[model samples]
Target: MTQRVVVDPVTRIEGHLRIEAETSPGGEITGAWSSGTMVRGIELILQGRDPRDAWAFAQRICGVCTLVHGIASVRAVEDALDYQIPPNAQLIRNLMIGAQYVHDHVMHFYHLHALDWVDVVSALKADPKATSALAQSISSYAKSSPGYFSDVQKKLKTFVDQGQLGIFANGYWGSPLYKLPPEANLMAVAHYLEALTWQREVVQLHAIFGGKNPHPNFVVGGAPAPISLDADTLAATSVNVQGLEIVKNVIARMQAFVNEVYLPDTLAIASFYKDWFRRGEGVGNFMTFGDFPEDGTGDPSKWLIPAGVILNRDLTTIHPVDLNDPMQVQEFVAHSYYGYSTGKDTGLHPYDGQTNLDYTGPKPPFEQLDVAKDYSWLKSPRWKGNVVEVGPLARVLMLNAKGFEPAVELTQKALRQLDLPLEAVYSTMGRTAARTLESKIVADQMSTWYDALIANIRKGELAVFNDAKWDPSTWPSVARGVGFMEAPRGALAHWIVIRDGKIDNYQAVVPSTWNAGPRDEAGKPGPYEAALMDRHTLADPKQPLEIQRTIHSFDPCIACAVHVVDPQGEELTQIQVR
Candidate 1:
């Protein structure tokens, strides 16, 4: 008999998800379906409000990267109003963004993604002394911890022995894909606890400027900091080098762990569970809306990582990210509930746009191409007419292809240090390492911009902000603009329309909208759907932790799109029990 196995309300990650895998009687996996069940209408909520407030309103979409939305929303409005922010304001934005990348990347690895892979149960067997020795042997940055990991281990041991998982209460631990030895698991577990502290310290970056994380309020005209300009307070205007230094040190430690600990751990785990690399591999197409600090200039291409597109299984580059190029971008909502003019192109400004909601059951993007059916509210997304991967994996692969010499050199060094083949740099392990590597690049670029800002300030050239005055009256009789920025997740796009000074319409295509999206009109499965098709299922369903680990690696953030909930609560609760 064919069986339908459901893993609903996946825990330990942001938002809600219910995955159903269909198995044939012969025990081979035949099909999979991804479902999202949440309802958030930020778009609908902002229907008649002042366009400026859209930034304030949209920023509430997600707590982790609230500032990103704030920036994107305001930028979208500013694009609508044709306003330009000042130089110092740009620097502040860059600094906050830099801090965000550091904070989000670290949190993703340690708190969110680590538990999925790191075995808490196995940690009880690790030797503190051996872990310390291992730490000191790999990188001196670990020395800064000074028994931090040991204390964390002791705390975890207490929690586990008490059978009070607490922070780990909802984690999937007994999954078969967890392949770490007891000692390694123990070491990773301690780091996981230590990371909670590390993550808070990183958040201080956002606190200093935007005031708070999880939706910082820095917006269009300028950040709210409004320097007093007093000589003494101007002195206070000095960049928080100490905070930046802490972040730098934390990143150094992270790189060390990636090189010394995590890389080796991944290889060891993958060796034991090689089936992962062979299966769950989806369409090899990848895309990156490139990001990095500006060299006191507006030339994005000169930024550390230039934006680009990649296609095909072997990964080839396509240059010059042209948002207006019709052949380069299109959206098909055939399977989505949203109403739009059929065969609409995302490039043709939002002013001349249409949105309609029509729903149809799971259907293939094309004829003779159904594996399973999508029950997701997400629309199947395609990039410039092809299926493409996004996130750290796509970013890393694109950077690797661009031959960004620094990233390339560092990646090679990372692979060699772990005694792993260079090919290993191409799998799930590669995704984790790429995030850390990108963190280093961003941190370094941030320091450079800091120095440039100081030079501009000393030269009395820092423009705090451009005038926010705009004749909402004379505004383009009919204007449409699209804003694109690299969010921590991947490329984030917002399409805006303005008529008679009120938002005629606004649409945001977020990162989750791409990664977790259902089938588009063409019937192509989104990236995550294709990736999960061939995963190995354990004999015990309760141990679906591997699924959790693999999916979390994408750092899926569904909040920006919609809320996913499970109505069949008892059925889900029972799966956890068995």
Candidate 2:
């Protein structure tokens, strides 16, 4: 006998994600379908707009990933125009991207993903003194004390007694799937609260560089903020002596927390959930578009993260990736709620990508998505007709394969501590752990990039914007380009064609679309579907904490992957949070 389980509007994620699974009588997930309920029309919105202004509109793809889209957008315009930004601009951009990586990974782990493993209700049963001892044993973080844990427990107990978990509501509080003991649970809950406060300090890096956040300023030629050394106008200038010092201090705080709290917590929690390190290994293939340029060259050789494709978990060879190659990266809409001019089965490269709405009725009460037809709003993106996973794990795997020192050292250390081999990093627990490891690495890089910026400033080199190609009259009659970065979630890119200084065609193939999209024309599942099918068993289909663990491991940012709108350019649904 087979059972169908559905989780609609999957909570704790950025956008509307629906998962339908078919389980065997033994409750092992036999099959799964990943669906992005929302429809993304940002690409459509960019049509006919100024090529230079695309970044402003594109960054609205997600409120959480505020700066990444702007980065990709500006890069696309720069690539098309063959524009060059200064060395200082590159370093500043790297700092901003690094800060985003650390901030995003921390937030995802604590506020979004950690609850899947740590039971808040269980923390109430913990002995505060025992929790303090457990915390101190694993990490040197100073917040752990009997009184501190007791106070956290008391606050949570009040929520439970008052019949309002508030932020902790709707969790499977007593689920058997959660492996953490009460004391460990209390330790994790304390850090979760701490992370919320930690995030506020890090985002100041964005404010310092971009002048604002959740939609920061950007320009096609270069960074919008000019570096002003005048101390008198420190308050008014985006990049000033005061701002740089604040940024330096913020990097220190980020590194301190990751070293003391996040890394230790991930390892300690993984010890209890060793079984997960062997399961939830998704599609074996992975890809990264390389980001964080050392100089302003935009060459793969200068990027901090190398670009390549790893096929079938093979560390033996790294395949070259070409964004401009028509046959390399293509989007399939056969199973998506979009259409191609040729046919649904036909794949179109981003340069020729289309966004035609082909919504089949999604009038709820779905026994299961019509697996035989279009089921997701996101288009399934394939590389050379093969499914590939992208994100922190993909980048880490690339680093491990290429023998990047820090990644290799961190992976080996984590593996040795857990008594698991290097191969274990391919599992769901590994995916979650990779985010934590990457956070530390990025936090460290933030300081290096900051020092470089300071060094350039000391040398009296203060160019953050390039006005060489700022005027549209200098652009060619026709131009096209692709801008890419390894976003916090995964690899993200924007392709644009400019005709007569206007956006002729625009398409963004985001990370979530690559992972959360539906099956391809060949009927092969994407990463999310494949991961859930990888030895995942639902202890209680009603709760489905098992499903949440695997899915959250990918850190779904559906709002960036898909959007919502009808053909009439009007709202189809008004989602009320209540």
Q: What is the C-alpha lDDT of each candidate?
A: 0.62, 0.90
- Which stretches of model 2 miss by more than 4 angstroms? 566-578
Candidate 1, TM-score vs. the true structure? Answer: 0.84
RMSD of each: 6.5, 2.6
lDDT of 2 by residue, 284-381 (tens): 99999998888888777878799999999999899999999999999999899888889999999999999998888467666678889899998999
Candidate 2 CA-lDDT value:
0.90
Poorest lDDT segment (10 consecutive residues) of candidate 1: 569-578
Clashing pairs in 2: 39-563, 39-564, 40-563
lDDT score at residue 232, model 1, on the 0-100 scale? 43
Per-residue alpha-carbon lDDT of candidate 1 for residues 170-256, written as tens digits (9 for 90 to 100): 666665667767666766676566567666656665665666666665555666565433444421233344543443454454445
Steric clashes per prediction: 17, 3
Best by lDDT: 2
lDDT of 1: 0.62
lDDT of 1 at 239: 37
